[model samples]
Target: MKNNINIPKEKLNQAVSRGIEKGRQEKPMKIRNSSMIIKRVASVVVIGGISLGLTFPVVVQAFPNIESAIIDFVESVLPKSYSNKLKHESKKNNIVISDGKAIVTLENSTLDNYQFIANMIIESDFFKQYEESDLEHNLYANLEVSIGDNKNIVGWGAHIRKIDDNKASLVVTADVGDIKLEDNVDVYIKLQGLEIQSNEWKSNDIKELKGNWDFSFKTDKVESIKRINIKDEIELDGKTMTLESIEVTPLASYIKLTADENISDKWVFASYKIVDNNGKAYRNAQIDGHTDEKAWNFTIAIYDDLSNIESLKITPYTDEQSIPSKIHGQDIIKMTTTMDEGSEVEDIIVSRPVEKRDLNVDAKPAHKYEGEKISYNLNIDKEKKFYTIDELIGKSINTGDGTSVTIKDITVNDKNTTIMLKVNGDYNVLSQVVLFDEDMRDIYSGIYVTHKGKWPSNSHWNNAKDTHYASGLATFIIDKIDVNKKYKLAVPIQKEINLNSGHTMNINLK
Candidate 1:
């Protein structure tokens, strides 16, 4: 939620100096949540890297250059675009703190406009009691951070793992609000508590540690955020949604779109799928977007480098089959280190990342919705056949293009309205669901869950039948819908195919 002005492309190549939490949420989350654990909208996000410092750090009289800054984390944890941005911002630090019982080190750190990661290692005799079997041990440390003279208290989240009986590694990430990296950036961390967790035993905790781990280090100021102005429009829920601008950086691209008529109130998360010219697809976990609701601006963070992208095929997708439910696969990561003789442990290799694309280009999506509509002109009166919400539960409506939906149930509560539906026929992706009032104001209902019908276990998208996964539950926020006013349920003639011809805009970066 830092200042976003959509700087003009001609005036942009300069460094972007603010700090942002690198996750897809409505805004940058502060670190005070359960110490440093940050939550993302699409997936659970944590920082990366490991650090070990046996002694207090001295100003590395000779600062380590970019090549030696443990840049491997960028390659491993981040998308290519993010790694590229953070790789330059990384600075090596060996700050150490100990309170007789345990020790922690701030080994390496990086900061840019989008986010920051602090690589740390904590060692204590206190952890020796927890024995490791075939299972892995994890130690989560609750830490808080602050940046520069602004005393901006940042939020943090950690990914911690026990490396040895007495040692553990952690990647601490957080959001430093409105701080400029060009200034003398000083970072302070207060180590609060440590939790020991594993499959076999109850978690144990060590509360409130003594001396803090405060460190100050400077990084190269070379963040290049590429801004491109675009004026492409796509129809969403019977309205024109404009793709206004896109700002690309190594960390992530900030894509701004304006929804017609200020959709701020009825907005659900913008679901967009991206395919590069290489046919490499990027979606789900790597993409996160939010709307500030002012001027109807929606900003999406696509964690990839799009500055010089020769061409792109981007679309607002609603099909469950199009977006991944969770992270799928990983790449082989090997970490090699050189050490002197007799050191307890000299090297560690930890791997984490993504997965496969497609069996073949000819493969079609498993479930996709055809252009369809729900009659918006119907009045909800008890005298009408499908007038009452409860009366419509067992009713079936055909979408004309070989798709139909049967309502299993509809739940109305104070918070939201939930409709359980069974989709019948070919159109498995049920288009965009909405609730329309007599005045024709559309309220988008979010489909939170989709249960695919039973099918062969290994069936890919190409061979999957429409009936394989035919039903889903979509919910709309129309708390206790006004009974006096007439409203109708609808599937707003959504297109699942990639926007083609006039609907899509091609950007040639040459």
Candidate 2:
């Protein structure tokens, strides 16, 4: 196996600081030096805890069986939940892209069913000065990622932390596209351009820097992600709910759920809740899904510990008001887990829901928002307004200033209209592009703000070149929208766009 990124020789003490995970006792953070930076993104903070309840003494385990040496990276940035699985694994790369002014090298790398990830080490004296600059927003990486000849699996990169004074580590993750990797597949990355921003990270981007960094190599290794068989059907308020098997890794748990066939395009669901048999509550569900005319499948990832969990008590909720057994919902699903006596540390097992359970939360709800990783509290419209997903579906408005907002996905329940809005181009100008009613009021129950998007490939690429992007979710009042009528959208900040609706006018979509 040819390594594309190589770690430079250095003492272990020359490392950067990482934020500690809340509420968990974690082992010491390790550092490893290496090469390259970005198809990067929002900072992904891994959440997990150490249970110390292992039935037996366990040594630090690797993914197992593979021969590629798990080099001590410049920083072992793997999430605590997955630290055991990925701690010792890293791709030793030798390919370096340098334009004489800067360098990008691929270092620690791993793969799963979702995408490929690599730690990119970058060293540049000029760029390192941004850490002390008066500007809060200084740099951005524009990259293109490809996997085994896929037409468009462009990846995203992110800045993890500043290491030594001359170096910083970046992580780039690319979607797997429709193709599947078997034994081995070649991967490629290109740093098309480097951008700069003077305002907030969401501000307009200016491509002021240029560099040539490209690396590619082939390897047969993949992170050990396991799927256990779990099949059960339960009846929800009005639809059929099926519980599929869960995908487990040292990083997190992906719980698979399916709704009844041909459910309406817009639907309602009880917010889900899960707890360990020990009464430890798991809140804040992160959701991803597939939607079509006949199928609606969802994968919910729980970023926490799953070991020592004799069983899991799963419950569904509409909101916090109906909590602690006053649930108009059904019983919790008590699931049994399985594992070989001595499997690899990465090989965790979770069995099917063996029986129904009743979980009661004793404390007040601690989690704020549920779906998207929102930063602030959105004021709920309070009115139980409903809207169909088709009202303004697929509509978009692009300003001449390079700022645009697209209506990505929408779901309506008896209580609110949740819209997934994708903002592209200039980030600072997002406050100007507002969704409104005929009266031009910013009608929303609560506004879910988004910044880095956690770099999930769930948004659109517009079949265009790489640039800065952000997204959000907003819930609205008004029982439903009149899909039969035209809707007005505004970009009030860009008044120079010359609109017929006057200076405060909005772009109308029929």
Candidate 3:
């Protein structure tokens, strides 16, 4: 069976020549390795006691007869949720094929109604010739796996574990495209060459380690596919948006929305989620794409049974706001002060129904300005439902510059709570703000202050302003707060950009 697998003549010749050298060696060759480095700030600090409960109603059952070797490999590589699903749905498939230099063993595969996964191991003595320079973003960046005729299935994700210094096991997954699989039809599995990312993280180098690693398997048809289409209209802030369709399957729910051509103001939503009739909340809502100038699409992964949901109520943001940006790190100030750990300062009170202004601030060139003086009683246990009060200012340190962020006032009304802030020195300092409980533990960390207007489409707040100061609001949905309990706020002194290497994958089942 191995002799029948096809390999390009050049790759076969290279493998044979390398094999001759391996035949004479006393032991396998070793390659010097340089691992990838990732830099990120801790988003959440799990302090003592306080915990937020996030739950989904999915029932997971273990799949019997899985190979112990493959189960161990899969658990090591994939995410906990994905690994659990794979374990429950996988079937054992023991198939081995080699191309003289590297041996690949297919251990198990899972075929869900909408997804497919393959688990395998690759043992290659030839890999020793390449050193750390041949490594990619991590390890496995070059490993390729596919299924169906003509390599129709490209892998969506892969988890790899190096067993020894030379061999590795990989689990690859794909979202089986829109095309339905036929019963007993041949499903071809193929492993292609590997790519290595250079120092610049670009795929400029590829190792042509080719082989005839192929297998044929039969698949029984799946019956769990389900979908629903609903054309519903939703109104927000006097603007109308249409929910064109809602698709529900075992894995996810897809929602489509479109705007009317006559509408002038475009709407965007944040903290959006669907609550079913049973009061269970699902917050997996993600913006998939903007279909056109007037339309948008989204996807929400549903882990529970679709039938368990009778109706859904969705929360959408109606009000949009914008703030301009300012220059940073110029004429920086420094100050050191001492205060009681939990002290009460001063407060300026305003009348009820304070003047509400539209969030759209006009764009202008950056300028330095002395912001208005703000003061507030540092009281966290005010029982007033709404506080029209003076700003509670905090000093932040950024690159030797002391910037000030003032919480102008606090409003607790309805289910939405907003924190209005004025940036006196620099807007970048407010990039990270955390609400900490008494023990210096986080109640909410990594809170992003987003604008509603069209100026700053990018995620950065600095793009919205070129001035010396800016003001914006961060809104959150909560039922009620325990104001009696003490809390503290923390913000970064300098601007920070969390480094992220973006890699994309496309899945087309059809």
On TM-score, the candidate that comes out on top is 1
Where model 2 places Cα greater than 4 Å from the true spot, the runs are 1-77, 81-90, 125-129, 132-135, 150-157, 164-166, 174-179, 199-207, 223-226, 234-237, 260-271, 283-287, 316-510
| Model 2: residue 289 alpha-carbon error in angstroms | 2.5
Q: Candidate 3: where is the Cα deviation over 4 Å?
A: 1-85, 88-90, 126-137, 141-155, 183-186, 202-208, 233-300, 304-310, 314-510
Count backbone overlaps in model 3.
17
Show model 1 residue runs off by greater than 4 Å: 1-45, 52-75, 79-90, 129-138, 146-151, 154-156, 175-186, 197-220, 231-235, 238-244, 250-253, 257-267, 283-299, 302-308, 322-508
Q: Could you estimate the TM-score for every candidate? A: 0.46, 0.44, 0.41
| Candidate 3: tens digits of C-alpha lDDT, residues 130-151 | 4321211224324333345545
- Give the Cα error of residue 107 in candidate 3, in Å: 2.4
Give Cα distance to truth, residue 121, candidate 2, Å: 0.7
Report how far residue 125 has shifted in candidate 3, in Å.
2.5
The candidate with the higher lDDT, 2 or 3, is 2
What is the Å distance of residue 307 in model 3 from its true position?
6.5
TM-score, cand. 3 vs. native: 0.41
Predicted structure 3: lDDT: 0.36
